[model samples]
Target: MIAAKNVSLQYPDGTVALKNINLSVKPGELVYITGPSGSGKTSLLKLLMAMEFPTTGTLEIMGRSYGKGQTGPIRQLRRMLGPVFQDFKLIKGRTALENIMLGMRFLDIPASEMKKNATEALARVGLKKKANTPVENLSWGECQRISIARVLARKPLLILADEPTGNLDRENALNILELLVGCKDEQTAVLITTHATHLIPANQNRIIRLKEGVMEEAEA
Candidate 1:
């Protein structure tokens, strides 16, 4: 569902974040982008998500090409993807239920239907008990779950998670991974970027490792 060819990214200061990366991810596949710090793992994800444009080469989402300052095409591409950040970008004052509902704000779903879907999503993340709690009052793990629940509510064609389990304990991290994997289906592609090797599944065949801005097959 996504492809990047000879993609390179450089900052205003001329620091190269990604270098000639070529990669493709298909629907229903769960892939991990693993690499060390400064290896451009996040940069690759940002390009795929259309948050950043590559300074060189091409990035294709679904079928459209994305280039610098092309907000119309980028926004159109993003509507089909759901992103979960490592920082758990939840509104502090909003309740978990509200946070999840925010994902469908662009849709014309009624308030009641939105609430129902949000509640079900929270239940899926084991956050039903904390549905009414403010995000600022939640623990780090709970906030993370809320982030996933928000993505689930969107039902995007592709899911992009960046260090999704970074701040959680072992059990919590496992639960988050399970939720993420469960979200995949024939129409959804899931791509995750993480530094923790243990976070990877043993039977996964789609893992791609990034090193010094290059892509390679992740060893089992």
Candidate 2:
């Protein structure tokens, strides 16, 4: 669950990345954020991730509010989130399974359960064959799916994905989107930022469009 009320993000250089953004995301909801380059899509995700605090307004993620430079609370809040970064962020020389397991090392999960979750997540992404394969040897799309597997393995309440399909073909992109959408449940929500609007299927899911740092709901 996420709530942003008139949130605005401005850098120290006076660059305004987001303006008066209002958003609400609920559990089991799958929302797509579509916009062009420098349109504040990534900036909004950063705010939700607590990588940056709002210069104005308020943001509550999972019932926790973010403040300026609240490192302790920020760390605690982030632990409840599953983030899929644009860059694979997989450790080089590590196998796919290891990369997935590495994401949960700090959590309270037992070693065996961690391995089981990692293995299951990889299989769910259709990459069980690559379990032992070094991530550096995998293709771009594979790396992306591995990144997703890393997130799914964590089982966080909120999933924040930044351009998970940015570098794939149409088929792969659709598959990736489907994989992410399938992660939602009554206790989980999925929010994805992508520029490719054509790949989005017809559904009742929410779509927020950002243009020139302004946010608006896309027409149904």
Candidate 3:
């Protein structure tokens, strides 16, 4: 779960990236943050990821406060999170399975269990057959699914996907979104940031909008 109260982020250059943003996300919830370029969508996620500290207000991710002097805790907190970066971030020459396993190397899991997790994750993404293929040889959407598999292998408590559908066609984008939504369960919360509002399904109600550093809840 995440809780933010009056959070604001300002860069050293006097640029305000977010303004008085207050939000609460609970377990099993899938929330979508939508905004245009230069909006505060990514800024808000950076704050959650502890990549940037808020200039004002408070933030609590899974009951841990994030700010100055919390480096160690922040590092530990990151281990519980799965972040799907805008860039696929896969090593070019590595096989898809290897890429997923590489992500788990830092964890305390055993090698056998790690491989099991990685294989299962690949299956979840419908890429089990391509597990041995080098990521460089995979299609763009396949690479994206592989990225998601890497995150799923970690069994994270929270999933933060930033623009996971940015590079795909409409059908692929929708499929990617559905795949991400399927990852949500009783023990996991999902937060996705994207600019393509039209791609969002009509059944999704937990939506937030940002513009010029401002935050507003979408009308139900």
Candidate 4:
């Protein structure tokens, strides 16, 4: 559902964060992008999310060219994507349910349905009891799960998570990974960038490695 061809990214200060990276992700597939810090893994995710445009080459999401034409198509394409950023960008004043409802605000979904979806999503991440709690009151792990629930509420076709387990303990990390992988069942594709090699799912064959802005197939 996502493809990048010869994509390159350069910062204003002449830093080359990515170099001729080419990658493809199919529907219902779960892939991992593993690399050390400054390896361009997050850069690549930013490009996919349209948060940053590639300096060179093309990026296509669900067959729509990302860097071309009107922003309507880009926004529409984003509607099908759910991103869990490294920082867990939750609104500080909003409750967990409110945060998740924000994902459906643009879709014209009914209020009742939105509530139901958000509750279900939070329950999926084992945070149903904290649905009405404000984000500021949550612990680090709880906040992270709430962030994932916010994305999951949208039922996005593609999930782009950057360092999804960076702050959690091993058990929580495993639970989050299982939740992500379990969502990849015929309609969704998941791409995660992480530094924890041992956390990588053993049954999955799709793994891509990045090193100093270079991309390559990772060995099993």
lDDT scores of the candidates, listed in order:
0.86, 0.91, 0.92, 0.88
Query: Which candidate achieves the best lDDT against the true structure?
Result: 3
Off by over 4 Å in 3: 218-220
lDDT of 2 at 178: 93
Tens digit of per-residue lDDT, candidate 1, span 1-220: 8877888988888888888888887889888888887788888888888778889988788988877788876777776888999898898789999888988887656877888888889999989999999999999999999999999888889999999989788888888888999999999999888888787778886778888888766443
Model 4 pairs whose backbones collide: none
**Ten residues in sequence with the least summed lDDT for candidate 4:** 64-73
Question: On TM-score, who's better, 3 or 4?
Answer: 3
Judged by TM-score relative to the true structure, which candidate is superior, 1 or 3?
3
Ranking by lDDT: 3, 2, 4, 1
* Best of the candidates, TM-score: 2
Candidate 3's residue-wise lDDT over 1-220, tens digit each?
8999999999999999999998999899999999898998888888989999989999999997877777888888888899898888999889999999998898888988999999999999999999999999999999999999999999899999999999899999998999999999999999999999999989896999999899966544
Q: Report the Cα lDDT for residue 215, model 1.
A: 78
In Å, residue 86's CA in model 3 sits off its true spot by: 0.6
lDDT string for model 4 (180-199, tens) is 78778688999999988799
The TM-score values for the models, in the order shown, are: 0.94, 0.97, 0.95, 0.95
Model 2 scores a TM of 0.97
**Between 1 and 2, whose lDDT is larger?**
2
